[model samples]
Target: MQIDLLRRKIGLNFNDGFAEVWLWAPNANKVNICIQKTEHRLDMLAKEYGYWYLKTEQIRPFDAYSFELESNTDADNAKLKRADPASIYQHDGIFGDSTAFDLGRFEWTDQNWKPIAVKDYIIYEIHTGTFTPEGDFESVINKLDYLLELGITAIEIMPVSQFSGNRNWGYDGVFPFAVQNTYGGPQQLQKLVNACHNKGLAVILDVVYNHVGPEGNYFNDFGAYFTEKYNTPWGNAINFDDAYCDGVRTFFIENALMWFRDFHIDALRLDAVHAIKDFSPKHILAELKQHVDKLATENNRPYHLMVELDLNDNRYINSQQQGGYGMDAQWIDEFHHTLRVAAGQEKTGYYADFNGIEDLAKAYNDAYVYNGQYSEHRKKKFGVETENPGEQFIVFSQNHDHVGNRMLGERTSTLVSFEMLKVMAGAVLCAPYLPLIFMGEEWAETNPFQFFISHSDEELVEAVRKGRKAEFSAFHIEGEAPDPQDEATFNRSKLDWNKAATGMHKTMLAYYKTLIRLRKENAAFNDLNRKNTQARAITDKNTLFLTRSSEEQIIICLLNFSKNQQNLQLNLPGNMSILLNSATTEFGGPQPTANAIQHNGEISIAPESILIFSN
Candidate 1:
């Protein structure tokens, strides 16, 4: 029997007095829609493909409802009241009644909005809860100009989907369609997207489609949403290839489309694609791309799907014609890891696999440093070698995982010197890939982004605590990991916006602004073609010389990783003039060299600094 996954719209679609509800439950003998406000129950007609649907003029928009599913095997024929798995709004909680929302009612002012190109994107990744003190969508709206002033092209928000509790890293999100009620619900999110589009800032939403979170997870009671055939770090993997898996795939695929079609989201950053286990002839990601491409063609605007994948396999970003997943771009963890190692991160755990300077150089040349190489961390040969375009990779110095996963959750600012911080920023911005900055990274905010969650289950809380500690046991960090359930942990993670305007923080902010400006305005730096880039690591002096060139202009970037000043010479054709120097007095660094053209292609670089010379 063939199941048409997109045959009918799931969830409650409500008008003024008309509503159509659809639920997927193959195991249910009967299903009923129970309206919470009027206490009215209506029996749904069981249609083909295991779907129960009801079309009535009784329910209106904003009405809260729950599904009643009666199993045939139950001797009592008891019907269980469960929140709609396809809920758009869950006002009360994740386990409470689902609210029917009129998504078309929002007045959008971004009809003429144009999306930023993927190659030129300078992304500012933000955690909604901690990005502002108010911890909501409206509060973020207040800081739009601030972000624009910082020169980021796009704002990549961390997951805003409804999670177990008010506070989470958002990986624990269960309801894929429901916007977090604590974060002002679905309408607020619509407003945020609309505002971003109007401001010429593309919004990239991070979505988790791996294993669903444990708390409030009622998928088992409804249908076959998970399978024992595969397991993720979270638990049993989402059913993507098992029997009745088409419905599960369709549910998530529709969720992705809803973000773009309804909310006007510019792009979606698919979280951790490596964990998504699917062995179907046409993989789930490929199927999603096929659908997204179809919508993009109709909308007449480019929509993108960037993925967070640790797997160095380029198949995810390769085009569908080449038998690949067809993702627009992917987060390159190798770039982050190798750069961190070169910047003096402790060579332990995953870092043990990277050998600093050489590896960083390799990452700059090839997208993956460990391509087809034996990895000490994994104890196996990892990552196939492939030629992927530079624009297809998203590079960053320090993101949430880098800082938050640590025992104390220390930012790069807390871990490295101020001069080295400049070097780190230059390394990422100067690369031929798109750059992403974590929230508060520009001004070097010192707040620890420690892991925090508010799961209502005490046993689950304890398990998380124990699991966190066990995960860090190999790192050899002393003291217990911070209590993830504690409110203090979440509070401690909030950004201090005031720091961006004061003292060294202000200077760092200026430095970041300059770097971003150069990245956007400079001809050579703006070109993302890997064929026009060259990176060579000087091991003895601990320096890297990177050359980027456009058809008309060329620039040579010198980065010194050592703490000592080093004199170096690049044997290039023409005389080079200093474009930007991180060690200049204007950027809060000691002026170690007079600004002049290197006629002989020789110059002295300051300790832990970056210098750009253009011909």
Candidate 2:
């Protein structure tokens, strides 16, 4: 099997009283393993297919080691020393040597855990470093019960790959296999996943396979792991279809499987797959899906692969038999952008292409607002219509990218009013697609999730600062951008959990709980068939009507985007009663009397509020 063959082809594999070490260095004349804190060295014999291998009894578990390579060509003659690209544990940070550890020893208690259906997922995205003051895997385990209480079915953690200085957003990670040492290393992460499964929560890990970080990157010295033929915003694209690309593909494929097979991850949210440049006969994503499907079949469990794609193409989520990549789901950023624009957010950058509620209504009808339509932002016709089901799309009002990429990283709570916050929450939960919420969003957190990085290289640090300031030029914000390299910036981004217990924050928490409960208990909300969904926007009244139905029940969500109260009377089919009202005093709005007065198809809706009704 390709899975078993790839697993044993690279890195250090420990057996009975001996260890087998393999490294893929197509351009190296010789390779040697240098033991940490000792003078011991082992020379590896070159085998076929440019693979260096050694079977010796000297290496043991937890043994720190580094690879020393001799150059084969005069173009690059300098001898190189670096950690394993597939290191499982980098205990002493990214710059330190790699450590060998046994993966089969962890006692997993999640053997009986079953996968949750995509239609029933209420995903909660979190950044482990900023989730709590402690900022580690063990700390995250302490909050699994809190998530359960909030009615969250899945927890999607930001990338935890080993990066420099332990303060990155995880996109700057250089090591693919190693878990961040500052996040309690591999064992603690395994414990957290195990604990989440025991508490009936699924875990989705974010992985970046488009490009590697700039700092501590030694791929250039090793082999052809990068290609100059394509460029990404981060830098050169990964060598997916270039020469000697088999190793690069296998390396990342192993990384994805390791998370599922070793760490027991339920899903993987692929970061920025649009940036992955590949022109091979079989795309890398399709190949990955094939491997994951086989693995899932062998284990008798379902493993999901989700992607973050800017392009509104359905080929990523379509089945392989239908000439697609076979992704389970994708992040629908258009829903968030259109919803924000309709809520009176500034129409700058990509938001300029959207025009209020009309675009939002379009997104409700079709998954993409720009399906083969001209976009002012891109100055071109973008996207194609797809017939994918609603459950294949994940929608959110606020996420890490939408909030953190801003000049000051202001969340929706700080950007909009309290009533509008309730409206936004209701808008997401009532949609046919899967819903996701960012950390601290339920209680309306005010802390800024600003961009921050901690790199030791002064040149790279300065470059990041300048690049951040330049990226914000389109938004035209006044004050200077936050210093990404500053330690204070990271400290200010931590969530203040204490705020959730007092004042409006407490009320907002209750409102979110109610919204989540309605989504779960109501058949109209839980059923994800888009065929039964209907949406209409009254532009003059600045109102939107979203009606969803199932065999058991039917519900309608009325949203008022204006800041003025509007009263209307319309003829309808059945007698409707209020299910939930955002304008009630319990949710920090006006008194209960300010709520809708429904009588004979006539009602009054408050400004910037949402009212859900059912028959």
Candidate 3:
């Protein structure tokens, strides 16, 4: 069998300890290869094809190994010292050797675990680095008990792949298979997943398959892994449909499987799927879905593959039987836009297209603003009507990108009134789709989630700072952008765990706990079947009423967009009872008044408030 190595001219014979290492030297006639393992000389055997094979019987894990390729013709030949591309454990840095440890050494306690179905999922998207003060996967395990108590069924962690330097947001990952060495590596991640499962929480990892980081990317030396056929905002798009695309697709699929099989991750939240351009007969997304389904079936677990697409394309989440990409769910930006616009908040960028109560109603009912209609933002006809059920959409009041992309990374709580925040949370948790909460969103943490990275190159740091400032110019933000490379940027992003037990944070946490309890206990909230959902506009541009009902029970939700109180008339056939109210002081409301007002054919609504009535 012939296997092409990644880079350099290295050939190894499994039958012999001798391997041959070569370099293309058109001007030189003689060359020598020197192998060293942490100052120890190893016996090397010369083999054909200019390869030097060394005996590995004495080599153990974490052994630092490097080769010095010399040319006899030039006494001052430049030495080539490179880390193993297949290295599983990198302790000091990128310069390490491949460990031959067995992956099955760890004993997993989640053999009987099964993931919660997509319909029943309540995901919490968190960054492991900033989720806790400790900033590691093990620290996340220490916090899983809180998530379970808060009723989150799934934990969607941001990317944790290996990237340059010790710290980053993880989007600039260069090694797709290796876990970040700074984050305690593969064994630590496995422990976190097992801990989550033990607490009845599923783990979903966010993966970036659009483009690899510029630094530490060596795939080009091995094969044609990129092309100029397509481009994206980030850079030249990944070569998904060009020559050798099959190998690239397999690499990603295998990486996905590794997360599930090796680390026990229950699902994957594919980052920016729209940027993943592919024109193959079987789209890369479909191919990935097929493999994921097979793996799920074989393991007898509810494994899901969710997508983050800005195109508003419903085909991505539609059923596979209907000839659509078989994604379990997709992020619904419409929901966030509607709530933001209705609350009379930020109007920059995409939020410009969403305003007034009508848009909010449309987003809540149909889950899309375009729906085959003309879009003023794109200045073209966009988005197909989503035939998928509501559960196919993952709705959120705020996420990492929504807040972190801002000029100062201000959360929704910072922009809206305290009462409005509760109303937004009520709307989000009660919606038909699966809901997600950003890390500090539950308690309205005041700390900002700034964009931070640790790059070794000073030039790259300056360029990033300048780019961020330029990007914010369109929004008319004042002042200079914060330096992403600054240590303070990363330190500020860490969650102050002490806040969770005091003041507004405590109140917000209680509110979230109550909402979760209501959702779990009430049949009306838990029933995801679309037939039970019905929306009625109370005012063309100020208020809307959403009613979800199950057999012998009904939940009516009234949402007021106005900033002042308004008198609302109820025309229901049955008696009504107030189950939840965002206007209460318990949820940062003004004060507790009439908790339950009789139908009386009329009800008064506070400005920018939400009311949930059940009978």
Candidate 4:
């Protein structure tokens, strides 16, 4: 029950006619719940282990309030007002007052929904701020049908946690529990997730635990929420192993479980976990996994935790009983890096280390390309050898990091030719890994996913621009870096929905739909058992032919990344038939006279083309 209280309790809990507020403020001598409009103050009772509680009928749903704190850290030990760190909903925005909300008030019809396994996840990642013109949760609900038509089984939303101002990448969130008020707050988010569940589309929320935004962070005033012992790219690290770390740990762990318990989210994507510094025996990641799995069992639904780490550690993907963090999967950058460099991407920064075809083959056959190998980029040996299949890795040719982090914010559509795009698409989907397609990637939306955040603080804004400019010196990027603070930069990043169904965009969208269908309809595409899958790259021909079988039928994908046409011979046991042909006129091909798939012997592959054959 102590653990359940740690997970299920906290924040404002409403029952019958009254609201009960729970808070963790170890450093505060006294705390008062203040009503925003009337200034009604209610003293909270302090309990054992630094917990405080107050039950009052005066507090009800949608009541805007803030905490009045009397702390020893103050200049005269004077009282100050601050928004709840565990606020469920904010009134105006993160800069405004936190509000009380009742989850029971909302209606939901997805009680009988059953989500698919992690291996079957075809994730379509969306940045809620730039996904639509309105850029709110209610507006995103209007487009869920369009996503389903694209053949995506899961929708991974970029973090919606409350950050400063109206717009942000959401990595700068300070209020971990509060939904962004600019995105229609918590109620609208609930509607969006529930609607997605009803449409048989699982929802994955991107969350950042590594660091918090500079503005609107009141954790320092309340307790020991940060540690100066270690330094990250974001300056001070979170207090995970320092004094009063228990409350800090529980606070984050509870925030994770609250999403699954209250909002009904299927999975969470932990962002940039490589920056997370923890030395405790029971890591914060393991604690989160343990709590999530417990909640999953109680709710009787599938729960997944996917980390964005460059460490290439299988412990994240391994089962808990095996002494791992028990994460269902992780986003591996090697597959995308290898495929891009092989497809003629400029070798800059870490891209310098990847050996085009060799790395591609290694990523396809094994989960990592640098397992126990020397990394010229980092000037050291990186990663441990893992026998785990592609199921443990989330591979993609294009993602937010690869595109948004670029100096010019150019996607695969802008970087590569039309023909090579199809080849890369086939490689991503055909590989034995969980495939994730970024928003507007299906129809090849031309908008650049630039780094933008609307912070009201001018000093912080200047710091961000200077940091970005300093960071750009390392990359081979052309043109002036877009000012992340400018409204034009944020507006320009928004997807052009109308263009998604016109000319080549329509054709590309159709081609992507077909690829997704093949992956979903065929069992061989997702059968991630490495023992049954074979990946061979014909280095001489600059071609890759990956084959997967289920003892019944074999799925073969022949990809030609070369600029010139190549001829390859197949030594197969069964009669091969074409499952999908990228050289067909339907996908804007040259209308080749010869068939794409040959049963046996020799086959001609068009330049920068792909062909999927099943036997």
Candidate 5:
């Protein structure tokens, strides 16, 4: 099978009391294994298909090693050498030597764990660098209990692949297989995933398969891994369908399988899948899904493959028999745009296409606003309407890109009032699509999630600082874009975990926890049947009404987006009682009167609040 043949014998593998090292250097005439921090040297014999192989008993676990190659096609063949392209762990830094680490042994406690369905998952997205004060893997493990108490079913950690320096957003990963050395390396990440599984929570890792980072990338030195034919937002695009593309496809496919077969993760959120340019008959995504589903069946576990795309295309989430990619779900960013504009955020760039109320309604009623319609922003006819179920779309109000892309990466609480914050949360928790909450959003953290990076190259650092400031000219707000290389920028983004116990922050946390509980335990909230849900907007009053029902019960959510109070007499259902009131005094608001006020079909909604009633 292709999955088994991908990662086999590519790196340092130990078997039968000997270390077998294999390297795929098609252009090299000679290869040598240099044991760093030691004086041992070994020569490799060239095998079929230009593969260099060597077996030695001198190597031990955690031994640092590198390769020395000689080839006339290489630019610096006699000058310097590169680290293993398939390194699973790196020591010192990304530029350091690869280590011989074994994945055969770990005290994993999640033997009977299985993943939850995509329609039932409440994924909480997180960035390890800014999630805690220490910015490491163990720190995140310390707070898994807090997530469990909040009724979260899964945790979607951002990328942790090895990057240059110490700080990054994980999109600029240089080493595809190696875990980030600074983030406690491979074993530490294993511990975190195992802990999450033991807590009855699934783990989804975000993987970047687009353009490689600018520095410390050496795949081009061996063969045609990149192409200059196509231009992306980043520089050269990866050569997925070009000459010698078989190896390139195998490289990324192996990376995806390693996370499932080796790391024991439940899912993978592929980053910027639109940037992955390919024209082959069997697309890389289709191949990946096929392999993953087979692996999941063999292991008797649940697994999903989700994608992030700007194309607004249904083919990514549709079934394979329909001539689609067969991905499990997609990150529907239009929900975030609609919610932001509805709550009065800046309307510039792509936000100009959305007008809040109508678009937000489209997001609930239909999966896309631009389906079979002309986009004024793109100045072209875009998107085809599809019968793809709403459960295949993942929606959120705020995420890393929506927040950190701003001049100041301010949270929604910084842009809107506390009551409106609850309003947005209600829209997501009670909607038909899957929901994901960014880290520090539950209690409305006051800190900003600004973009930050640490690069050793002085020239590259200056270019990034200049590029970020220039990119924000299209948005409102003045001044500089905050130097991403500055240590203070990263420091300002760390969450104040202690704030969840006091004042308004504490109240918001309680409100979120309550909403999550309803999503989990209540049948009216989580039934995936489309006929059970309906939404409408009262444009004149700036109010939205949503209903979700089961055979036994019915639930309604009312959200007011205006600053003035609204009193209305409307025909509601029978036997109504309050389930969650965002304006309650317990949640740091004015203690409203008795919540059951539907007598004679009359009720008054407070300004900027959310009221959920069940019948």
Candidate 6:
């Protein structure tokens, strides 16, 4: 009998002189456990139903060990295998020997690093593969200085989990416990995080808990890790509340802890959390939050968990004290839609539902368009109103998914006017919610973020392309979706780093730098309290005027969404100084005689632009 002797549930409890190891083997009547270093062999004593435990005086790091199992009928029908699930340094894939890795091996220099508060975050999202031509964790470390120079507090990297092949966006991760060998594995990730911390930049890892990739998935061989009861877009949902769910939940929770404890990542950004179906008393998200919070408290380090959810449910971001799942923040897509529509640059798809200044105002004021109201897009009532502070929401004009999902993968820079781009940037960066900038948005990299994938299976590749086309056909987008499996698609998405030193890219980078600097230095922009931030539309026109005040200063943001410049009357309380202007000729705007105009009570508004005035 070729029994795959994969250890399903293995627990190791250690002390100074001795260690206790427990495992589950339903078909096994007799088990032989061997410790590599001490060469101690033990006949496991049955602790309970189909359970075995061994208490011995052997403890060493990187201790190679295996378990041999035998059935009641025959002694020759036994198999030996590794124990631990997360064997950091795997030699020959999943079936290899389990090597005990000491978490204290790496000497971390980030002793003073504290996680940036979610409310004060300005995130810069990057894909390790396309972020730089080198395409590795070390390459990202080399670029940390650039991110820090741009005033980004956190660097949210796309998933780095081990997948089937080398190059992938990491959403199709299979070995949730293993780091991608292409991206230099677990040690490289640790080095990246340590390097990021050394530069005062917090690291936020994007993790997919919705579904594992089809290939290299061996969870089923171990136990009932997934459920056929609930289904997701990808496939079967994880068994979060089923019979063997405790172990499954522990697997993910341990993975989270591995990233935090072993890799020293400051935060985790849960990807597509709405798809995590769990109909139990304790939802996986809630339980995970509790565990994370406890870990944070014990370590005396600031740990955060952000969620990417489309449910528009305020409960996701609400405080646990309010009978809600405690998440640090959530990505707000309405903010992007409203700003995009208000700027009059509506692309195909979701833009059809949002095309007015009211939407932008609602997005600004309430942080969501649904807010328990009827949504024409979904054709139903959606989203609960958020009573929490606005900073709990993360807003962005563009992201990897938004740009990459397009048929041609055109970015906002390709669709909107140069002036409008600045306006959108200003609106996003100055909003009460935390701002997230896509990889090259600071410099407006011309390269489109085309969707790309490397699937080993040919049939799945065809299905992916067809599925993409079917998705966009409903929205009436021109042309079929590009084949992600095509190498050209991935190649085209690489950022042209040289562009940052030239024309539009240079201008956009400067604009972003100035805006970020002002945001950091200004007390008004730092204010997270919604009561201090008030936004009022300039009449029923497509213009918005927002005032943000704190104890130290008062700032007002003026945005004009029209194509042509229109003279408008303004109401001001006191003298105002032009702190920042997105329409300056320096940022790909038309040359203007006046750059900074001090006004007593009024100001001239520029077309398709944003102006910040402070007192």
lDDT per residue as tens, model 4, 1-615 = 045722356777787777888888988889999997778999999987788889899987888998898988777999989888889887678778888888777798888788878778899999998999999998999998998988988999999899888878899999999898889888888999999999999999999999988888888888888999889998889989888888888888888888888888999999988888889998889888988888888877878888999888888788879888888889999899999998999788878888787779888888888888788888899888888776778989898888998877888899888889988888898888899998888888788999998888899899899888888777756567899999999999999999877999999999999999989888788687877778788999889888887767788888899998887888655577777779778898885542664445778889999988888
Candidate 1 lDDT by residue in tens digits, 1-615: 222233227777764467877788988988989999899999999888788888898788888889889998778888899998889899988988999888778999999897788887899999999999999999999999999999988999999889988999888888888999999999999999888888889999999999788899999888899999998999899999999998888888888888888888989999999999999999999999988888888789889999999898989999999889999999998888888989999988888898888988888888788789898899899997767788899999999998999988999999999999999999999999999999999999999999999999999999999999998978898899999999999999999989999999999999999999988888898888888888999999999989999998898888999999888876666566777899888888998453733546667788999988788
Q: Give the Å shift of residue 202 in candidate 3.
A: 0.3
| Runs with alpha carbons beyond 4 Å of true place in candidate 4 | 5-7, 592-594, 597-600
Q: lDDT tens digits, residues 96-173, model 6?
A: 444544455678988988767777788999999899998888888888888888899999999987665556788987
Q: Residue by residue across 1-615, what tens digits does model 3's lDDT show?
A: 122212112222122332332222222233333334556554444444333445454444334454444434456765444443334445555545433323445689987676677778888999888998878888888888888888889899999887777668888877676678888887788888888887888889999888887666655543356778999877788888997665566667766776776678888999999999998988888988887787777777767888898988877887778878889889988888878887777677777777646777777677886788887778989888765788888889899998888878888888887777887888888887789999988988878888988878788888889888988876788897667888898888888888889988888899899888888888988887766787766664377789888897899998877787777777655667788887788777774963635456777888888888899
Alpha carbon lDDT at 306, candidate 1:
97
Candidate 4, number of clashes? 0
Error of 2 at 221 (Å): 1.3
C-alpha lDDT score of every prediction, in listed order = 0.89, 0.89, 0.74, 0.86, 0.83, 0.77
Candidates' RMSD to native:
1.8, 1.5, 5.1, 1.7, 1.9, 4.9
Specify the poorest-scoring 10-residue window by lDDT in model 5. Answer: 1-10
Better of 3 and 4 by lDDT: 4
Summed backbone clashes in each candidate are 0, 0, 10, 0, 0, 0
TM-score of each: 0.97, 0.98, 0.88, 0.97, 0.96, 0.88
lDDT string, candidate 2, 1-615, tens digits: 134722444688776767878788888989999988676888999977677888988878898998999986846577788998888888888888999877777899988788888789999999999999999999999999989999999999999999999688999999988899988888899999999999999999999999999899998777899999999998889999999898888888888888888899999999999999999999999999998988888778889999999999999999999999999999999999999998889999878899889888888888788899888799899999977889999999999999999999999999899989998898899999999999999999999999999999999999998999889888887888899888899998999999999999999999999999999999999888888888998889989988999997889888999999877675545666778989999888885653477677777888989989887
Q: Which stretches of candidate 6 lie over 4 Å from their true place?
A: 1-101, 593-602
Candidate 6 matches the true fold with a TM-score of 0.88
Off by over 4 Å in 1: 1-8, 15-17, 572-574, 592-600
Identify the superior model by TM-score, candidate 5 or candidate 6.
5
